[model samples]
Target: MSWNKLLCNLRELQLSGTLNGGQSFRWEYNKEMDEWTGVFSKTVWKLRQREEFLQYKVIGSLLQSIVQKKNDVEFDNNGVFEGLLKKYFRLDFNLSDYYTKWSEKDDLFKAACKQFYGIRMLAQEPVENLFSFICSQNNHISRISSMVEKLCKHYGEEICEQDGVTYYSFPDVEKLSTPKVESELRQLGFGYRAKFIQKSAAQILEWEGEKWFAGLQDMKYKEARLELMKLCGIGPKVADCICLMSLNHLEALPVDTHVYQIAAQNYLPHLRGKKNVTEKMYSEIGDHFRSLYGDYAGWAHTVLFCADLKKFQQTTDSEDIKPKKRRKKT
Candidate 1:
């Protein structure tokens, strides 16, 4: 209901490179309006990039907690949203500093910095991150986004209906834990991933909710990964993604097909001869990037990953990137 403008430079925080880089899903780009509309946490937000600043509007808000408090314009407090935007965008982490440090070390990262400079890692909600990555197996960005959106639309709480757009909250674990939910997911075109999401949700509930997942946040990376692996359908890559994107384990590198090919083609040519990225190679690749990129290896890897994706397919918008180019089916 409230229209607002955030003054971050378009260069310092480009939505095209940052949000579209495939971290979180559900945002939709309106080409005509030049705006991106999406829900994150319980808020339905629309953002558009202008030359000097980004204009945003809180189109709708969802009810969170037992209070049933809605963040609509009638009760709108810009301070609450100000905090959310700052945290979501991770403004505390200076992009210019990262660019300077990374570009100085490696030419590839230097080149990556120039293209995807403002591509900061989003601080996603951990529960949503867990469920979202489960849907990512053998999936493209668009499919994953669609699956997540379907999950919200069907199971997630209905926040509001505005201008024919209905906003729903990401479904709670209780909503997704049932076998019925799994069956419904298949009907929704989730295919086998429906089971993965259903089982993963149940496992978290079995672990007695966020306490266990939050525990991983404090764990060492190896232990953190092993802990995540215990969940059904979670593997090294998925666990690593959860760790890096949500759990604050910046060194976690989720090696997928794209990373493997890029490494072989550019960084490690010996990998070119290998038919597949074996377990050993995966660890080696992760370790190599860690050695190369240091503490924020995962973030650096993502920048390179997005750069590679942008290179192969001229993806100026996040919607344009797809998983067909992903090395999974190959």
Candidate 2:
């Protein structure tokens, strides 16, 4: 099958890091194929990158039927899926320009950008983003991902299957709001988050239905965050996460331990050696980044957060080290 291409720079859209990073947890990389497959925006996508293009394949019965019929599908001609990809990836944003601006303003960001370019924030679905972060409370990426997959498998509608693997769309609020959902999720290893997921879904449905999330997009950053906090399991951090990731609030910075450490080490010296991040400290850290990075402080924070991750530590260690000189002895 022929692949469709979106003209993209590697420095602006590194698929490996962006897809598998903590923002969204659905993508799986195939080492042999040098590609990634993930379910998002209600469809499965297989993506890879060449020098200056992001190559993609839409994998599903409906899309594949159209592709087989057309033989060579041009995204320009078929706008729906293409548009979804563009919006989901926030393709309209010029990340390179932001990188330059951020690098000029902050030395730490400039340094981190050296190894962590192309870590753009994904505009994920709010429902998916909400539950995923609920699972993220005191959880690692691997486990959060596992719980998310279970949520889809058990409650979500099956979208399609490929190569013996089935893809499921994230469950809708109604589907997740069942009376038995909490118990079922507990049995499926969701732990305490089971109640959060179920109750939040129910609350959302009761308040204004599924469209409530769309309404959040139209709200100011603070307003949207306050609204999200009204739901079960959503606190300041998770609310900020949903706002930045889904509700079009780029300025919303979610301060977890990772972000707090980043701030203490490079920006806020007084925060160093603090045993816990108090509510006052959290607001202070967020305000500091907002002042430094402006409207897209959350976006900027994501880059530094990715740079600080242990998986990427090897690059930081090797690249940042300077070789010793021995020629003086000779």
Per-residue lDDT of candidate 2, residues 98-170 (tens digit): 9999999999899988988888899998889888888878766567778899999988878888889888888
lDDT of 2: 0.80
Writing each residue's lDDT as its tens digit, candidate 1 over 56-101 gives: 8776665333223443334434666767887888877877887788
What's the number of clashes in each of the models? Answer: 0, 0
What is the TM-score of each predicted model, taking all chains together?
Answer: 0.91, 0.89
User: lDDT at 62 for candidate 1?
Assistant: 53
Among these predictions, the greatest TM-score belongs to 1
Q: Return the TM-score for candidate 1, rounded to 2 decimals.
A: 0.91
